[model samples]
Target: MKKQIALLLSLLLAPLVSAAPAPEREKAQPSAHHVAIGLPDWARGSTIYEINVRQFSATGKFSAVTADLPRLKALGVDVLWLMPIHPIGEVNRKGPLGSYYAAQDYLGVNPEFGTEQDLRDLVNAAHAQGQRVILDWVPNHVSPDNPLTKTHPEFFWRDEQGNLTPPHGTDWTDVVQFDFRVPALLDYQADVLLHWVKNFGIDGFRCDVAWGLPTPFWNEVVRRVRAVKPDALFLAEAELPQQQVAAFNLSYGFDLHHAMNQIAQCKRSASALDEAYAKIHAHFPRGAALMVFTSSHDENSWAGTEFERMGAGYAPFAVLTFLLDGVPMIYNGQEAGLDRRLEFFQRDPIVWPAETHPTTRLYQVMTKLRREHPALHTGSPMRRLDTTDNATFYALERTAADGRRVVGLFNLTAKDAKADLFDPALAGEWRDAFTGETVKLDALVPLDLKAWRYRVLVK
Candidate 1:
């Protein structure tokens, strides 16, 4: 009777176990629309260098930047992204100098930075050196004292008392938000963009707070601008996937940047990078370009310098920015190891060192490698190679259509770690980018990396 009871219980459980459904796999969420924009030929393999004009030199003038063109060319810079060049509003200003994003005029140059012709000459000089120039454009808002506030009151958003307001959910009191619902405002902004491209000969624009505007506005503006300059580049400060659909050629890699910071602080492991990349691949279109960087204007001023946040992991993370399948950027004072938080709304200029900094060589080598190897360019295919220590060691291989290949090995921890990379595809003779030594890999390659060490090999 006991044996009979046990058989009956097992029979009842077998059907329930078989009837249970399998767990569903996670799926990637792609953008609503397909990306229609193509990157300009000039930007495919290029690197961007941002210049905070207000803090770049003691004079903080366009002439100073113009004078540095030759040096920039020698440093392997292909694009110069100048921070806002318009006059800052005096009313409700943040500091003595005011915020650079608070524009007073769309078509006028800041007297503090010199005359309009000074900017024209700077653009001309950069173009002569085979470098492209992009302006940081503030379209979402303008200074409270801007002429538009009085002249075209319809272009602004107002509260119940009919008073202009700042951008929603922020403490940016110096500037008033724009009302994109007004058709004329769109037309005026479109014209403003065209004016720079036509008059100043600017290669493109870096749209500030781009996510605040509607996508259709950017689509229409890009359509109108491309009608004038077919290869004009547009970079969006936002990370929205839709921004790259038909407007921006590049968007910020905010997720990846944050992941790097987290990993550096030991709050997360190197595997966090893989998760970040997976999300990026899932959300963005196949060929969308992202700008990878360790530091930027906002990051340097508000949060902290790279050294403060990333500490000893700074150099290795910088190497990852260049090796990854995206266009890399170098902030103005990064090469000189600027470690202090620059005053955002003041006249704190960067002090120059008489001798060349070691970081300059690191950036030069990285940029040179990008120029020589199409495999390192944006839109190239990247494959992750499995390693013995996946949590701390990260390795990847990128290959271009022209059969060129490059590999990067990074140890994202602060302790000694060894990883035996296992990838049959890695079997080849490669040249070391830094030491100029030859490395031959078979089916397996053992890497003994010190804390925060990295290696770049080209084939």
Candidate 2:
């Protein structure tokens, strides 16, 4: 039996690296052609909250997250994106705890986090609160110590000496690349994805390095998964436009995120946001959802916290993430005003403040604005209104189909500035989103904005 298994592995790995024939449904789908997928109705006005389970609490357990669901629901989180829950591979691990991306088993829950029952309880609790849960799934690679390396050696890419290799052009020596050329590997991956949806009742997945895999694989996976759960949501951790075509409902808005950073540091003007939006509009298909944010796990651990990167302009940028024509995401601890970079490989829990932080209130206001106003929902029409000082002042109006309107004015610089907001669209009675004061805007209204201040006017 052992000799026969070895021979089977050799046969599977003999072919040159190439994508297997796409599933029958993908036969007519061109690689570059994009067709916008229908988004789940529940996500139309939803906000995503990313959870770093390892650093979310002192215990770093699923039970801890379960205990905090009420607070998250009150914070207006609609989707809870949990980081990988699989056991980490020990061989060639980066630090004492190892990277969460280094999966030792696809089917096993990490004991460090909790038992499988614990994860199920967390998902059930989230579902009871009307919040969707998506697991972070790494498809491009796996830890060298993964069980598949021994049970199905042909599933991995090997060097000339038949040694498993890391992904090309990266120092990620801990994880070995997967060979999607083998048809059976795709079947295995699909089964693993279905297992979670069927058993644990996870809503969908947030695929890591989604761009690394072939589009055909995603198309097939989406078809298979949705066959079971039609409303499953797929979020690609990439900005590639093609990924949104019939596979993923949302993709990361990295370009806009970078533009926000540049504007905050004065390396670019507020007009840079316009440029970024133009590119996004030109590239992505209409009705495609984009997830926009100022900070994430990668930004917090490798780059810096939003406080360190955006400095005084952090609040304004956070406001933009909500106001923009995309779904907004809040990284864990962001509401608590987490200032320091988190250790990626060690046990470093977020230090939550005893009292509610001011940032929490800011988020509450923004989230309330998002939930209550259809005009601010994803896929709503957003028009950039011209201002006198386009370099420092950014103004835009979002209008929903039902005639509701929300206008935002942002001072993207550190210096106080005044600009004339003159547009027929700006003529209306508006209430402040933060303060309840009412104001009227007429033709050519002159506005003085303090450094890094932002105003959200609802009509």
Query: What lDDT score belongs to each candidate, Candidate 1 first?
Result: 0.88, 0.89
373 Cα displacement, candidate 1 (Å): 0.7
Q: Pick the candidate with the highest lDDT.
A: 2
TM-score per prediction, in order, is: 0.93, 0.94
Off by over 4 Å in 1: 1-29
**Which clashing pairs does model 1 show?**
none
The per-prediction tally of clashing pairs is 0, 0
Q: Write one digit per residue (lDDT tens) for candidate 2, span 403-443.
A: 99998999999999998988986777899999989989897
Q: Write the per-residue lDDT of candidate 1 for residues 73-135, one digit (tens) a residue.
A: 888989999999999999899999999999999999999999999999999999988999999
Report how far residue 188 has shifted in candidate 1, in Å. Answer: 0.2
Q: Point out the worst 10-residue segment of candidate 2 by lDDT.
A: 21-30
The candidate that achieves the highest TM-score relative to the unseen native structure: 2
